[model samples]
Target: MRIEKEVSPEYEIPAVLQHIEARGRRPVLIFENVRNLNGTRSGLPVVINLFGARERLADALGTTVARLPLDYVAREKPLAPVVVDRAAAPVKQVVRTGADADLYELPVLTHHEMDLGPYLTSPSVWVRDLETGWTNCGILRVYVSGPRQMVVNFNIARHTFHYFQKYKAAKRDVPIVLVMGHHPAFYLGAQTKLLADEPHIIGGVMGEPLELAPSETWGSDIMVPAAADIVVEAEMSHSQLEIEGPFGEYTQYYGGQKLSPVAQVRAITRRKDAMYLDIMPGRADHLLLDAPMVEAYLYNRLKDVVPGVTAVHMPVSGTARLHAYIQMRKTNDGEPRTAIASALSSDYRLKHVVVVDEDVNIFDDAQVLWAIATRSQWDRDLLVLPGMMGTTLDPSADDILTAKGGIDATRPIDPHQFAMKLCIPEAVLSRVRLEDYLTPEGLRRL
Candidate 1:
């Protein structure tokens, strides 16, 4: 939807999206008349909530929502990138170097009411290892501090931080390229857990080779996606640190202010008519971007320890990072505990895991809750590990350590050993049609 009416980048865009979410709709919004941070109408349009719904992501991957995780896992193999000339790269159409590269020309958004200032919410930062030359890609938050400078928040556990450490140890600046506004597959591929060149993985997810173009700043040594709408070439300082954030995060809470690495913007390049993309932080758009990737990773990990694992879900209620629900066809009582341990160890951000039987619909909150209430006994089914390393973003964590807990909400394998669940006969359920039974008015009311 295109909004012809003028909208301020600060809070107004997010406020409109929040109201739409309350009404149970998430649509891609295009603000044609968005005011820049400098209070001038931006020539480029602003796109928000592009990946707000799971169905849209699935559609982008050419699959149904139910099959998204498995599909991602199956197609996540590495495929090399094909390089293209500058003339063929749309992002190189308009290049600005040094002082001419003004960030305020774009509509950078201030998402929440308390945000420090305008932020670039959808940057996929790319950096390469000095020794192995393996490139790492990560979607990181950037605070727009000035026209030529920005502060980047990098998680210590992530590869970007690891590469930054190597650069810092050598007292050398880290060469970085921030790619913005590409196909959803480009971002999805960057979420791979594998430690390899990410452009190849991006190609795999896109089902075609990712086209690369030599960077104007670093030339052939560093390449940017040829099809990206905007690409910012910058260098991360080795010794410089700046105060960044009190910014809204994926956990639906504000991350406290801390010193973070500063990036000096050297050049900016984009398509002639680039669209500024912003994800609604602490909302479905931010959380769901990583949900399917995490689910697929966990599902693959659980299969090694528990072969009967049927499905995995990271519910939105848990902010898609804190809680996980695993569905499995249990052969023995020990599998649930094993799955929990494997899952909890796989990611530091996960705090809780609930293992349920295959009969339970793990996607439905009510059914999963019912399984927990009916089948789990705290004394027998609960598993807790204290003082585990976890993300500090978790508000409940004590510094970098937090407790991890899990529940085995599965009944015995033998059906006759436990009380039978209430269910309608399959024959009757299959025959009954709600559309046939209900009147038009009744259906409309529903």
Candidate 2:
């Protein structure tokens, strides 16, 4: 319940519901207990780092995994926020300037044993492209090295990569905003795959707009909540690079320490009552962010590719990013392969995607495997493509390339003598319940 008081009404209940949905394995909510990292000043305890199970992610999005992708079709584009003054901002309720703004004092977590230092794992960095005037909001890892220095890891293909490339090409340092400790909805909005700039998707999802405020230290660009718990205004020098790695990653493996660009913090603005949110780099954090996003994007990508495309399930074991289970109506014979091709091309992140019939629950891997066993012939259903691009965190992909494979697990209809096809009666399935053996509580040796 620590999150209830500090978080908005929408975030609080869903956070708790995340636990309920997972039953036992869901992410645990941290209650407030601020410990100052400097041994002198401490941050206020706040709830943070919620993720892992599908139920947990579903809670964050306020929907089930099954429905999330369809929601993207709604495409509620957020309007660029109107900037407000610092005095009017609740985030400035307690402002720390220059050295007083030392980030070392915040209780940032050093997630993996090999991490260079304490890192800000979950952040929605807001910046603008120089030539295009396009505002960017996306997630990247930030490692705290000094009071004013943090290391940034930008994937070669990420928006940050393009932005950084621009700066590097011009030999100019780029200044940007790093925001944390706000609504989970903000994180959801940042996951969007659209090429356009949108901070207003939060408003559309919430049925209203989110309030934003300008940074006292930086100009124009508004940070989240109009009162974010912690905001860092940072500049990145394209020429001045540093090694930024050996950190654990979403891929569930060590990213093995990387030498990357450094973020020079110019000024940090925060609430006196700020509670730093520490998201562990791997596992849970990766799941919550990846699952719902994959569910939404894959569905959107494969919808028109295969008719009767109903749901996309990114099970927890697949890291929710690497593997996807696609469900569709098999209107024709080659439909599954078509769905697989579209899905693979949709996002560079997906390594393997399987398309199954409506009878199989995409969410349950067991049923999917069952369909593969009963309905598919190895040669007929399997499709493997050579030399595909891999995601940044896909350690298995070697950063350069990897192979792609998919299975068509739906039962094939007979082209001839189809009238003899058989199935169980719906009424029998609905009415027959073996309470004596099937139910755990019903089974007793005595």
Candidate 3:
């Protein structure tokens, strides 16, 4: 079958609720009928942002997000995903038309009070493979226009933008499909390291190929998630334009929305009872978007450079790819530098990198800082590469140039002086909890 239909969005909502209840983070799976400023409820439902949590992120890849690449699978030869036709596709169960297609009718939340309007958040957008004709599905945010249209903000120097630009240069509309709703992985797959053709990588992740249907809206060339909640098929024109954003972005910063290009959405196909995925911007949704993408690149690079670079943590709290900590064995002095260099080069978006010995879990910021404080002698251990590629969104890069830096946070080894700290037993903690020191009743007594 082109699409499998077992799980429901409702099943995933509780997981998000628990995450928010515990962490005070943002990752809402809104299944309710969405309304616009006009307050009109629509029958069609859409899933906005799927990259909302590390767990959901893993759910996207069909594995635990914490699982390192070394734990399973070999990339020696990636397996191709299986594909089927629209007849077997659950996403195409129902289809919306041009007149009936009122985008504002769907309750696309204005996540933060400052948003460009309701945007299409959970789209594993499919485009033609640059090399072959295979379709490449990647999560990209497309802004909603009035009736039957969206404005895609493909961003400067992005691969998607480049692909569309190729078509734009030729005065052709880039045939595309924004898979409205699907597993978190569909979005995660799109955020993957841009290496070879990625549609096949989706096959590798699914352990099978996807079923696809020819986009009737586009002339025979476009195909999409057959089971998508919506397939917004439209073409572009040099004449069409609109002022778009003022939305909260992944950086947890407000980007004043501006005018962008326009495309007329001719057709939208979906499951009759499809779930709309909405990821409130400026929350975990934004951070998780780039984490695994950054992780995948680090995983591959570190493995080749460091002898046993088991894991790498680009802490979400660190703004996705900006700051990263790499876990590697203390093979020698060169390995840490190699890891740092690999990380800096792998992700142009990064600000700093801290490489540490295997004894230190890179995920622990305190431990990493501890290593930096004690073992590192600032001038000697640090490495800074100026004029390298990095994200302009970075406040540090506000100098308006591509600048980057990294730290070999690992201890310059003097094997004899090393000592591992001992930890108190958990049983002891159970015997004497924090309540003993600061009790609700005792506080008043004090």
Candidate 4:
């Protein structure tokens, strides 16, 4: 939870990666004097990889990773947001309007070679439903195109796009506030698949109420998180479109350029010493941010369909989107196949799913692979559905349609041979300690 602030003045995007590498998986980084492309220092500090590690994310939610789903489900009720005075809001400490609201002053990083330009990778986009006046918050990739303009990629499948469509239909510009830098729980809550109002409910579950402040341009009806380090007030024009992307995505591939919505910045508000946040696309930070949310969503969906579902894990190796592992207690003959089908149907982004017995550790790739290798029979256990709508980021897909498959890796219902795995007795395991058996030097070598 400690923020590292003694960053070198010359440090830039490459230096951030070097720091991550040097620290050997430190979860949070806060850099001061971040160098921009113009070889000048930005006054604002930068933060990256806030949720890069599993342990850090777990700590943020006040629970273990294995118990996050239960924790998330328990806090589904919305808590009304408390409106705070502009003076009481930390984010409103310094407000810039008109010409002073320049985006170039921020140290937004260019993450990869194929990326178009500096992107505000971790902005929590806030928008309201045109008809209902209900607020919606979610994370979207934004390309910084100009001082007062940015291009936003809105995938039609996401709720944010639906909200934008309503605004477009009404012939009105969509008012949005792109919030950056808050407690990790705020970011995690924003990513949740909510059936109701998200921001306050998520905050309530995280043991706090989300404080709100009125937008400078959008009025009191449109609120942004008061705790944010920086807030960009913008309006996505109903008719204007701009070329966005060719930026690296979580799928580890360049998301091709397409005509997308153009946002015109109206004002910028920040703390006097604002800390900018950026998510490294196609890296651990991006995957960790998305994976836990997907796992929680799948866990909730499967529990209703398959009552015996034990756990769900979207492995990091699969980029935490395209592949999934579901652990369940099998009682019936066709339960594994049923679980697989239900899981695949839960999320279109999932291209492959492996259903394993409760004995298998879904978090461990080796254990899941071992279960599939030993228990599965290709002809009988494999389930394939072709021409299904899938993630556009998947390179193998034919335009958004792709084949989906699943493996029933659980052992047979009345198994004789493959039912049990060999293990050491508890009595022997309890008495054994590697550190007690080895010398300090030997332990160090090991």
Question: For model 3, how does the per-residue alpha-carbon lDDT over 372-418 read when each residue is reduced to its tens digit?
Answer: 88767768788888878777666657543666666776755676666
Q: Which ten residues in a row have the lowest lDDT in candidate 1?
A: 152-161
lDDT of each: 0.92, 0.69, 0.64, 0.83
Model 4: runs farther than 4 Å from truth?
1-26, 37-39, 438-446
Best by lDDT: 1
Question: Which candidate, 2 or 4, has the higher lDDT?
Answer: 4
Q: Sort the predicted structures by TM-score, highest score first.
A: 1, 4, 2, 3
lDDT of 1 by residue, 300-365 (tens): 889998999999999888989999999999899899999999999998999999999978998888
Candidate 2 residue-wise lDDT, 1-446, digit = tens: 35433332113333444455465445455645434446442546644546545555555557765666556446447655556677877677876666677877665665555667667777778767878766677777887888778888777667878877888899988877887777666666776666666566655554456667866565555354575777888887788778887777777687766678887777777777776665655556556665665677667667766657888887767877778888877777788888888888787777888778777887787888877777677788898987998775776676668888888877665547222336799998888777834756555532
Can you give the lDDT of residue 399 in candidate 3?
43
Residue ranges of candidate 3 with Cα displaced over 4 Å: 1-28, 31-33, 43-50, 59-62, 68-87, 129-132, 195-197, 256-259, 399-403, 423-446
How many clashes (backbone N, Cα, C below 3 Å) per candidate? 0, 13, 27, 0
Q: Of the pair 1 and 3, which is ahead by lDDT?
A: 1
Off by over 4 Å in 2: 1-24, 56-62, 221-225, 415-446
How high is the lDDT of residue 427 in model 3?
92
On lDDT, who's better, 3 or 4? Answer: 4
Ranking by lDDT: 1, 4, 2, 3
* TM-score of each candidate structure, all chains considered together: 0.95, 0.84, 0.81, 0.93
